[model samples]
Target: WLRAGGIQGRAILLDYASWATAHSIPLSPFTSQPIPLAHLRQLIAERSITIRRGDILLLRTGLDAALKRLAPAEQRAISTRSSPDFIGLEAGRATLRWVWEQGFSAVASDAPSFERGPVLGDHADAEHTLHQWLLAGWGMPIGELFDLEGLAEYCAAEGRWSCFFSSVPLKVPGGVASPPNAVAIL
Candidate 1:
């Protein structure tokens, strides 16, 4: 049980708008691809995005826009579908090393989960999934279903990925989770 209020830090948005726009496959989010670490690094360098220690990483998978295009009935049906899948950061030792080295305070994404869903494979000594590594192992909070479209657009227009971010969760004792109520300021 992770507390949402504990997760707060400077926010940075990694926009994959182009990728999402070009691909329009329903049922699977962003075609169920895993964002390679190299590609991620390339994006940061290309965009001149600077990541600092203790910063929160906000990944924009563009799932929100994709979902909105679906009919309400379709959306409802998809929502209830078992074994849903989506594109997200890869879960592995390399990814863990990168995140640890970069010193991200926490990681959040617009997708359903921070890491790709239906995670299948033998992850030997490593944690079964990124969710386990981040939340249980690292004690880092993970935020999902974030509305990052506006932020991604704003960052793109401004040519800045970093922003002053703040979040406050409801102070409920023994609460497992709460709305982030997060805000970002340029």
Candidate 2:
């Protein structure tokens, strides 16, 4: 990230990996979590961490098992959407508000969609809401399905809070989400 002038030692990555039950159980982070966005905001605020526009946020949601169950063809089909999970629009709005308040300019998650799955009610536009809110609303791009546990453990061990984060996405026009190969070099 130094090459890109983002390595002045103030990068933080958030985890966004959550698992969906074999039976439908609201897989999105916004609704399923005991500690929702408001609580997350409070936690960060208490820690004196500031989220700003253009800042990179990493999220970890344990959805890899579900991904593995999909056939290769199925996985390809789902990738066309902005996210693999269904995050509701209301939740999307709430998340955006918190993200902006925290000062994040960018966000990433381990799940396919940043929103909840099987989106219900009038908010059928869950995925759309998530993409538009972050990309268009916050002017923040998003990274999808990143591998964060290993690097997070490393960071925890080293007692460091900053690193160089980089991602390369496919140059596909009209693509909602890009298949990216990303890495954080500490």
Q: Best by TM-score, which number?
A: 1
Which RMSD values do the candidates have, in order? Answer: 3.5, 6.4
lDDT tens string, model 2, 1-186?
212532222357543232123223455332323225654454355435555555676655555545667899876876676533433213555666666676755666655455544333353445545566666765567666666677756755775545667676656567666665677888
Residue 139 lDDT (model 2)? 59
Candidate 2 lDDT score at position 120? 37
> After TM-score superposition, what is the CA distance of residue 52 in candidate 2 from its true location, in Å?
4.7
TM-score of 1: 0.85
- Model 2 regions lying over 4 Å from their true place: 1-10, 16-35, 42-53, 65-92, 119-128
TM-scores across all candidates?
0.85, 0.61
lDDT for each candidate structure:
0.75, 0.54
* Segments of candidate 1 deviating more than 4 angstroms: 1-8, 19-31, 120-128
